[model samples]
Target: MSNHARELAGIIMNRFDAFYRRFLDITLGAKVRFESKDWLGVQLAGRQRIRLYDHHVNETLQAVRDHMGGAPLGQEGLKALKQAFNDRLTEHANPEIAESFYNSVYRRSLRHHNIRAENLYVHGFIRRATDPDLTPYCWQYRTNTGALGDCLRQVLERLQLAVPFSDLTRDLGYVDRYLQDHGPAELRGGEIGLTFVNTLFYRNKGAYLIGRLEQGGLQWPFILPILHDDQGGLNLDTLILSKDDASILFGFARAYFMVWCPVPALLVHFLRSLLPNKADYELYTAIGCQKHGKTEFHRDFLNHLHQSRDQFELAPGIKGMVMSVFTLPSFDVVFKVIKDRFTPPKEVNHETVKAKYRLVKQHDRVGRMADTLEFTNFELPLHRISPMLLAELQQVAPSLLSIKGDTLVIRHLYSERRMTPLNIYLEHATDEAVQDAIDEYANAIKQLAAANIFPGDMLFKNFGVTRHGRVIFYDYDEIAYMTECHFRDIPKARYPEDELSAEPWYSVGPSDIFPEEFATFLLSSPRIREAFKQQHNDLFTAGYWRQLQQNIEAGCFVDVFPYRRRQRFRFLYQQGNDKPGDGASPP
Candidate 1:
């Protein structure tokens, strides 16, 4: 039995190495894809990368089952297997991730009751070692000896990009001026240093150079979004300074960045230093290791449960017809389970709902959709669950839950970052805040549409407000691709009775959507209606949606800046180019 366990551990490690190599191979193509401006290729690569983990896990699960002769490993066998796995991980570059892969294999190969430290890596056992001889993942630069502009030039030159900058001198001038005006006061005459990640982070149509600026004892995280201009030249689109804005750039709403790192653990460590508020799991997920992130989250959550006494209760918001959500008050994540039966008007089955969440996982979120971590055979202690919440779950999603002893096993569920539901947010918001949320709500719709996604149900309850005040869509039960939908304008009323009828007189197909009726359901408040009309009146017309569909069909990639427009140095430079007091600067 011990020999077989050792052999199984070796096989799993071999499988992990293969997966890691393939992951890096796919990640390496991101740089070439960005240089060639292959936006479609970027999307394809993203979907493929996201699918890799599960593909390998399923394959390894089959291998493990075959090796074990399709029988469960008893406690002694499981203990021996875990020990062998840990023994093989001593010098591993990413032992935490490898342990996670083992956990996935164990979880899928056995029943839920088999979950234990003896069989799975419930918590990380391998401590990361800092090798003195290992190469650093960041390039360090000192601004103390040279002009800031000179140091910036060296940083750009070090990238050794496949394409040349559009106008390095001009961009440097803009950076200099912007820093002189908006940068920290201490940066002007104080000693400063910059540390940038060695590899560029690629996602969608943009590449970002992530770094930190240090002066005195303070550190400010910064990001430079590099873009390919219309003239086929590379240009730095904007400079993002401050931790708040940097965190937004890495917000849970955005798609993962494709970053190739030889030493992923070291890279995550470096990123943590720059974004201290971000968790290790978030940093790993942002860099495209979502499976590992899920593992880290599970470990952290269990640890929190052990430390805290908070009970799991129903998440505060309008009840979801398709998903039953609950959370621990002290935690920032919500666990969502698909109900056995959805409420009327939902019209979706369990498999379909899972498919929609899968779609969200594989699609480009464009910073307007939340990312979810899917899990199966998850368990929780029944005692920690509030009685009210337990009764609610048993009522709606009983099919997904089973009470075995003191443990409640969830067959499957998704975990997502918690945010204030948009409807709940608007209830207490001041007039000004309501107006801002309304505008942001409209902008979220436009951005999702631009990315070729249509929120099938655009009610306020379907969206959420992030900590940064950005609105994002969270409901996946009623989402569809823009190209998959048929946008249509309502015909003029043929009779007085037709005008007053609650139901439309015209025939409607499954894929057909009437944009004209959107305002009726979306804008109930007069203030919200007027504010939405001021900025997004065109959203109510079918023409706007049709144009977006056409653009998507033509393979046009829309520019969606993660940062605000005013934060862009190019716009500021354009403002300066215009004559003073002329008011000719672009919005």
Candidate 2:
């Protein structure tokens, strides 16, 4: 051989060795494992085994060598060769081939751990395709198949496309037609009778279908079930309910959506804006009951009105009077309609009691009558009163009364035949008298606090004086915890070192309030100013006000009460000036 041929032969041998080493590394522990000893002694094996095995190995090695020629192995060249192998493996491991092999060997794997040919092909493909030197499987697949090729076709066949809104309507029509032709009688009836409502997707609330039922030319509102979505869309899986049962399922679905939905607080204002005058009144009444039923009349009247609407008519009675007394669980409100036949009383004296009785009796024959001469005490539960009712009472008479726990007892201002004296005085009292009354009220509150019983609401209206001038407290939205009272001087600007800012201001824990503020708030009244100075003046000062402010900010409003100051009323006869039996008046 010439010098060139010898160099070529050496290069070829080098190429063959490099290819064999690379192939061994890629295939090792997979199809073949090359022990160093076996690789060296391959030719020394017996004839039959040696001839068959060596021939196969030599043929594969020769093919690799020829593919490389005498070319010096470069990074690009090695990469190309690796990629080619991966591509071939991937083709053999395609799903069509894998599926066929899987079906064939699935039953055979019962006893032996028989591996399917598809799995073996896939394993080999993954091993080869994942090698760093190889081109990516996706790139190879794309280049080989083109954009509109087999892989794309398979994906399209597997995925169900979303239908457009227009298409959906068309399909729904087709469904109706199909039902008409072949569906069950019940299904056809449902389609015709039930209306298909529009679907909505609320951001926080979820999906809902709002439909109206048409029966006898009347439409009723209905809602569908709530729907949730991970990758949110109007996809089939996101359909909360099927069209067939959309009507029946809408109610629950609507409720769920409304409950879970993120509604803006301002929506309440928007809704109010749309309500008519009467509707607005009704809504106001409803919300007042739910939010502010602390006042007796508001709570009692609302309850009574609801009940009366169910039982009575609006016309006047034969006796020329209509009387209605309504009672809620905690309070009562009475409405009287008097006919022109009876003379109205100018003053609420004992002589006019018969007229008052007859007036109320005309409206509601079963209503209870008020005993102006006696002191009535009744305990009621708190939950029965609505907050709106309290608000209304506050507006009507802000300083005439208060509520404590469930009882709403009012003191009579003077003897009244038609109206209670307390009601007449409250309705007619001058603003100055009201203010003076409020001042005396403050002093009474201070005394009540000293008795270890706090009148929860300190509003001037919640306290009233009876015919005998005894102060009484009513309105009990918050009561109890009187025994836990502690008097402290609250600072105005500075907070006490012991007070923690962590607690809520409305319901601050007992230990958190500064006693000084309680003293300052008590001494704030002019009626109590001189008395407080003479008796408890040292307790009320600038330091006290500061501490009280801090406690108030910290939610110590309850601690400001004079818990020990509850007053006991003296009977009229006990005072030696009244004409009554054993200090008790006729009821």
Candidate 3:
């Protein structure tokens, strides 16, 4: 402590005693008969006890205004005190109990928000009369005013800043600038990190602290306690003006709190020898949150209230080994939250996000997914599809998707885009329709291959035939360029052990593929099997896909006409066999 600052603190403390004596006489009054509460030497006498507490609070503020001129404890200090008081007003376990010793203000005026009864000293403002170990008739609590006289007495003790309140909000801006200048990794290197008592949003009343931060080098293990306040995402501009003045507060608050409890940064440092590590923002928070559970472990009622069995979520995704089949009819359109990792779905790869750019040049038959949305988790983009856009499915092999803005809204599922999974729809489809669908499926594959696309998963589930008998591939998790894949022959078993092994004998990398595997996958049923064998026999060998891949890679452009031959204008009109200038045939 600097000599100059220590002298200012002493001046404030000396003046507190006289002011406390005067304030107590006013709130308690000259002639008021008290009830028989053993602790206070007299108990509280009134029915509207809560209102009287409010009255005492108002008087305390008024007294400060009367005695303490806008000098050391300016509006910022007073505001801090008020915010702390209001926080404690409603949530005290024992509102009546008070300090062990009394100067009229300590026992009669100043109120402590909470108390710990189990301790031998009964830590907090609780009087000896309320302590069972100290007194016999300690059942009913009477006093709430603890050591709160310090609010008026030692005003600038908590604030270790330049005097005269030249800049009430300078420290706040400093904290914000320090954080913005240094990333979380840099803060762990003996750097001081600042955290809010509550969040630093619009109605920010709680104080902030500057303390040393410690984080592990590996996996970035967050050593700082999960300070709900640290994640407020506020900036220096918040202290000035914000368009966000509409929403008042974010975190939970208690009932009728009146007094404030702002823990100073210096006091935090003073106790360093006993508690050396930075105040795990989560430590006091954990002690404060004995009533509820953290978000990951306890999903509250809102999670269940918004979900319905009727709603369908049709966006597709896979996280490593686990697959999220969002396009299924049984899908739930609710926003998914992934804890411990990124909360929302991250785009898996670069090409997946870039596909949208290439999609604009593709013909209509090359079905499109929802609009691509970029997320912070991955450098690529993921599809964000809306159920409302499903209305356009039949019209355009259809989908509606927006990438920007809050992508968490749940839209009502429409019937068209809610078409059953291709394999399931095939189960009840007519045999002729099944054959037509399989034929269209073959055409779609051949056309896509010619256009430099390869649907890595060639299962029936990935393709769906429209009512007009055109097959489209909607699943894109495993999609790739035709040139990037290797279509290889399944190696024959070279040793006896290979034949008996459960897995394949050949060494297969991620890009290595066997096109012959498509034959059995396409031949899942007898009718489709017979039809495919007769009509698309070439698809059974590795050579067919490889040839198509090579042709496309060699720059052989394949014209994918969307309309039928008869639907073309030239097909509808007859051309004369004569040279130019000959009259055209009538339509």
Candidate 4:
């Protein structure tokens, strides 16, 4: 035999000896004797010695080969077969003591392989070969003869071949070639097994010194001694800790169990890494009513917030209150641990606290007030402009912000201060400025309409301006379909005729609505209106609105007024002023 084959044979022999000894101990309640010449001999305490014949070793090897799909035995396969042989020997010698051993192996193997309950192929084979349905005797056989038999049968079936010594050798050769070509380099090392912890830290982390330990790589500093011995073999659980304390004593347990451990330790570690010795943000709480649900909805929302606390940097606060409906008695609110800190406005005094916004009880008996609080600043013309304005416009500069469900999260901006659309004209003295602003705003509404988004509470107070002067829509409750929108030629009186009421609210189709009047409602100022008509007269014409209405109804979903769609102009205006090139600036 070649050196590798000799090594393999030695490993097989050592495994057999261990199995034989363990079997003797369990069955006969005595240790087995071994001859140096590959001979296995067993003895009962009060009985004559029983010399193990070659048939026993031959049969076990055959069974193991059969179990491994007739493939050559890898280190893991060899270890398992050795364990099975020991179990079987114990069972045959003393069936009474064999039950526990058998059960332990059976349960472990079943769990390790994730064998489903519906896998009747193996179960059926065992049932046909044994009595009492193989269920009661499953444990005893599993430890000893049964595990080997099952493995052999499974391997043979997997290979779709007859069970024989010759076929087993042939299959092993095939498996050897397959592994030689395709197996990972690390796995090619003799008698070594791959594990995530070892590979992750050693190979990927470039920690070559630690890699030499192989399986010991997973034995972290605190967990090594309990797992290994002076001879370097693993020490079983019984020798390490008592059954009750075994779970508590282990430092690095299974991956799933490690995940289940409390997150506070990791959280602290992360915080320490980011801002060592510095104080962290305090938690804050906000309360509001569900648009169309009960307290359960509110509870679920709180749970979601708690689970994503790390993402939000939220700290803990009070329980607040639970409400059946949005009312004064049932409403509750809590403050976050962190203080609301923002840069003070340039005009504000350093020592004075500016009351920029207010947080109030959701159910306070304010007139026409909903449970939600309005976040605003008086310096910005938010109330006079649009309620659903962009975040950038509300501040001093432009910013990109998005709404996560009900909460607005600003991002990709240096500061929260946004520039309003009105501010765009305040600094410049362009003649067609007001007309340009109206056109931009009109185009924004048209885009929203084309997307089937009907702003139910479409009012100036609801919109905001970004630093870039682009309008942004934020409110979700009143967001609906353009198809559900209705427009009147003139403002409707408080007491309108019943003929104006559209019935079967859900039956409204996209084709039934007209959105051209949106420009009139949106640009209500007379000065701005006159400017829009003068500069863009076609904007107010019926043909323009009609064509827009047709495009929206057709559901093209394209932007009606994209920034790139603006008409190119050579000069600001033709006011016969001797300004260089007659108002035409050089490109």
- In terms of TM-score, which candidate is strongest? 1
Q: What is candidate 3's lDDT per residue for 176-221, written digit by digit as tens? A: 4433443343333332222222211001112222122223332111
Location of the lowest summed lDDT over 10 successive residues in candidate 1: 578-587
User: What stretches of model 4 exceed 4 Å from their correct place?
Assistant: 1-432, 475-477, 487-524, 534-555, 559-563, 566-587
Taking all chains together, the TM-score of candidate 4 against the true structure is 0.23
Across residues 380-449, which tens digit of lDDT does each residue of candidate 1 receive?
9999999999999999988888888998989898999999999999989998999889888988898899
- Candidate 2 local lDDT, 485-583, one digit each (tens): 443433333455436655423434543334445454544555445544443443334353344344434533221111111111112112443332211
Error of 2 at 339 (Å): 35
Ranking by lDDT: 1, 3, 2, 4
lDDT of each: 0.84, 0.29, 0.35, 0.28
Evaluate model 2: give its lDDT: 0.29
How big is the positional error of residue 394 in model 2, measured in Å on the Cα after superposition? Answer: 18
Q: For this target, which candidate reaches the highest lDDT against the unseen true structure? A: 1
Model 3, position 181, has a per-residue lDDT of: 45
lDDT of 4 by residue, 253-313 (tens): 1000111101112222222222222211100011011111122223333444444322221
Q: Count the backbone clashes (under 3 Å) in each candidate.
A: 0, 66, 19, 36
